[model samples]
Target: MATAAVDRVEMSEAEWEARQELAACYRVFAMLGWSEMIYNHITLKIPGEDGAFLINPFGLHFSEVTASSLVKIDIDGNKLDDSPYPVNRAGFVQHALFHRHLPDAHCIMHTHTTAGMAVSSLEGGLRATNFYACNFAGQIAYHDFEGVTVRDEEGARLLEHLGNKRVMLLKNHGILVMGKTLPEAFIKHWSLQRACEIQIATMSMGTPIEVTPDVVAVHQRDLHMAQVPGGAGAADFAAMVRLVDKIDTGWRA
Candidate 1:
C-alpha cells in the first residue's frame, strides 16, 4: 500500500500522537458507517499547541484521512500548515466556536449517519427508551435546525443550546459531541449512534417502552463509574484504534 510519509521534522511528539489518533478515528468512523462521503468532521486540538487544532482535509473520504494529511488551523480557521487541501469553511467555523469558547472541549465530532439523522429529524428527538440513551438521561441537549449552520449567528445559538451538555442533537441536521479528550468524544458519538439506532429500530415495531427516570439515573451512574479509570472512554477508543490498525494502517501516515 502506498502511503505518504508524515513529515515530522517540525512536529512535536505530542502533536504527532494526536494526529495519529485523530486520523485513526476517521477510519474508525468509516468502518462503522458513520461517514458522509467528504462531509461531516472530527477535530482534535494538537496537544501542547495553544489554540491550534487538526481537522481532516476537505476533499477526502474518511478512510483516506491520514495523520500527516490532517490540516492544522488556528482559532479563526486560518491554515497554519502548508497542506494543499483546503478546510471546510462551515465545519471549521462551527467546530471552532465550541473549541474556542469551551476550554474543556478539546475534541469535537459531528456526523450525519442515517439513524442519527432520522432521530434528529424526529419531533421528539432522542427518546429515553434505550440503554444507550440512558447514558445521557438529562445530559443531552437539542438545537432547532435553522438550516445548514453556515451563518455566524447560528454558532452562538448552537452554543447556547449545547450549554454544559457534551452531546447535542442538531435538530433536522445531525449530532454533535465534544469532550475534554478524543477518546471521550469518540465514545459519546458511538453511544449516541447506538442510542439513535436502537430508538429507530424500536419505534418501528410499535410504541417503545419508555423507561423510568430512576432507571436512567442508575444506568447513567453505572456508566459514569466506568469512566473514572479510563478518562471517559479511553479503553473503548483504544480498542477501536487497534481495530483500525488491523483493517488498514494507511491512516498512520
Candidate 2:
C-alpha cells in the first residue's frame, strides 16, 4: 500500500508540462471539429516511476477543459484525486488499456471525425493510395468493433490490436494515436485526419489517383525528415491557449 501511494507522487514538473500540453490538445481538437461531442478523449502518462495518467472529464467539451480540470487516474481507471467531473467509461477503458501496456506511449489521442468514420467503414481501410496515407503503412493497426467499449474485457482486445504500433484505425468507429509526447501524438492525429479527408474528397471525385512504391518511399523519408524533436507540442499548445485567452480566459478561472 505504501509503494502504491509512493507511485502516485512520482509526477514531476515535466509530467505537469505534459498534462498542460494534453489539455491544450483537447481544446485544439474541439476547435478543429475533431472531437465527438465530448465523447472522444486525449490522455497523457504522468512522469513517475509508478503508473499514473491524466484524462479529460466526461461531461465537458474539449474546448471547455482547463489544465486543472483534467483528472488523474490509475491504470485501473480509478480516480486518484478529487474532481467535480466524472470520466466517460468508454474513454477510460480505451486509455487505461494502452497506458497499462505501452511503456513508450506517453500520450494517446482518439477522435470520431466524419471523414475518419467514413473511411473506417470502407473495406480498404486506409489504403496506400497517397503519400499521406502511405506514411502510416506498416505502422497502423486495426481493431474490430465490440460495442461501446465500456467493459474491462474489451481493453485486452483493443490492446492486442494496438500491439506495438503507434496508430490505430478503430474500424467502423474512429482513429487512435499514441506517442511519447503530446506533439508526436497531435501531429500523428493531424496526419490521420488529413489523410481521411483527402481519401473522402478523392473518392467523391470519381477519378483514379495512385502513387508508386518508389514515390511512397521517398515521401516516407521526407516525412521523417520533416519531423521535429523535443516535447515542444507545448509551444504550439501555449500559442493556442494564448489565442483562447483573448476570447475567454474562463478556462483559467
Candidate 3:
C-alpha cells in the first residue's frame, strides 16, 4: 500500500473536499463489492485546478484509500503530487483522453465487475430488458473491442465513439461512466451494474422479453420528469455515503 508518505502536500480547501468525497466514493465501491483487487479506477477533477485530477494510488485496495492518500495527476498522466505511489498509465490512458476532451466529465468511473464484464462480452451489449436499463434508453454508447493496448490515436477513436454520451460499454472490456460530479458518476455506475446483473438473471431463465422502443422512450421521458429537480444524483449518493461512513470513516482522513 504505497507507504511512502514522506510529507503530505498542502491543498486548497476545494481540492481537499473533492479528495474527501472521492475517497468516500472509493470506500463505497469497496463496500458494494465493485473493486477488483487493485485494478479499475474512479477519477475526479480537482475543484480549482486545471489539468489536474485525483486517482487512486496504483497499489492500494479501494478499501484502503483515504482522502490524503490519493494520487494527483494531470491529463498526460504526470503526477502532480508528492505521494510515492505510482499511477497505472496503461489503465489511465483512456481516462486521460476523455478527461482532456470532455469538459463536463469531472468524475470518471471504470469497473470490471463480474456482471459488467460479462454483459460487455456479449454481442448484444446491454439489453434494455429491465427497469434500470430503461433509464439509458438511447443514452448508452458502445465501443468495439480493440485488444488491451490503447494507443493515443485509438484514444481519439474512443472519444469519437463516446461522442456526447456519458455512459459507454467497452466491448470485451468493461463499463465506463463519466459525470459532472462524483455523485452523478456513482449513481450511473450503480444503475448500469444493476442492469447488467438483472440481464444476467433474466437470460438465465427462458427467452426474456424486452420493453418496446416506444415504451422505452416514454419511460425515459417520465423518469426525467420525475427527478426531484435540484441535484442530479445527490440523494442516492448521499445515502450510499452514509452507509459507507457507518462502516468506516477512515476514508475521510
Candidate 4:
C-alpha cells in the first residue's frame, strides 16, 4: 500500500498537531478494542481551514494508521492530499454533515463496538443505571437506522436527530460522539462505551436497579462541572496519550 507523503512545508504547526492528535485517537481506539476493522471513522477538523478535516484511509486498520498517513479531505469527501487510498464516501457523508451543521464540533468519533451496538439496539437507548451512564442523561439523541449512511439526503435527517446533542445513538447501528476538542470526544466515547457495557452486563442478571432521577441529575451536574476548561477529562486524555506512546510511539510519526 502506498503511504501519503506528508509535506511538512505545506502544513502549519496547528494542522500537524491536529493530525498527530487525531492519529493518536485512532491508535487509542484500537488499543481499547473500539475499532471495527477498518470500518468506523474518527474525524478532526483542520485548524484554520473551513470545511477541511482529516480521516483514516479506507483500507488501513486503526492500529496501522499513522499521523503522516491520514488523508486530508474537504467536507464533500474530495481528497485534498496525495494518497493512494480513497476516503470512504459514506463515512465522509455522515461525518461531514455533522461538521457542517455543528460549528463547535471540531472532533467527531464513530464506533461499532459490541456494547455500543447492543445499547443502540435497545428501545430506550442509553439508560442511567450507572455513574458512567449518568453523565449522558438528557445529552444523547437517537437516530433511526436507514440502512448504511451512504446517501446525501441522510445528512439532513441525521443533523435533525442530533440537534445540539454531543452524543448520538443510531438505532440498531452504533454510537457517535462529537466534541469541541479531540480529547473531549475521546473521553465522551470512552464513558459512553463503558456505560453501554455495564448496561448490557447488568441486564443479563435480570432487572437492573436504576439510579433515581434526582441522583442522576446531581451526578450529571457534577460530571459537567468536572469537564470545565482544565477538568478531569482533559487530564485523563493526557494520561491516555502517554499510555498510547508507551504502547507504541510510532503513532506519533
lDDT of 4 by residue, 1-253 (tens): 3355566777788879998998888988898888887899999999999999999998899988888889999987888877678888778989998888899899999989999999999989888888899888889999999999899988888888888788999999999999998888888899999999999999998998888989988787676565647753687788777888888888777
Kindly list the per-residue Cα lDDT of model 3 for residues 1-253, writing each as its tens digit: 3334423456688888988899999999999999999989999999879889999998999999999888989988898888888998756787888888899999999998999999999988888899999888788889988877357778877888998899999998899999998888988999999999999999999777989999998888787676555577888888889999899888887
Error of 3 at 41 (Å): 0.6
What value of lDDT does candidate 1 attain over all alpha carbons?
A: 0.88
In candidate 3, which residue pairs clash? none
Q: Please provide TM-scores, in order, for all candidate models, with all chains considered together.
A: 0.95, 0.87, 0.95, 0.95
User: How are the candidates ranked when ordered by TM-score, highest leading?
Assistant: 1, 4, 3, 2
Deviation from native of the Cα of residue 156 in model 4, angstroms? 1.3
Put down candidate 2 lDDT per residue, 30-49, tens digits, no spaces.
77778777688888987863
List the global CA lDDT of all models: 0.88, 0.76, 0.87, 0.87
Residue 241 of candidate 2: its Cα lDDT? Answer: 63
Q: Please report how far candidate 2 places residue 112 from its true position, in Å.
A: 0.7
Prediction RMSDs, each to the true structure:
1.6, 5.2, 1.7, 1.7
Q: How many backbone collisions does model 1 have?
A: 0
lDDT string, candidate 1, 1-253, tens digits: 3334346788899989999989999999999999998999999998888999999998889989999999999998898877888889879989999989999999999999998899999997898999898887788899997877668788888888888898998888888999999998988999999999999999999999999998887787677655647587898988888988998878887
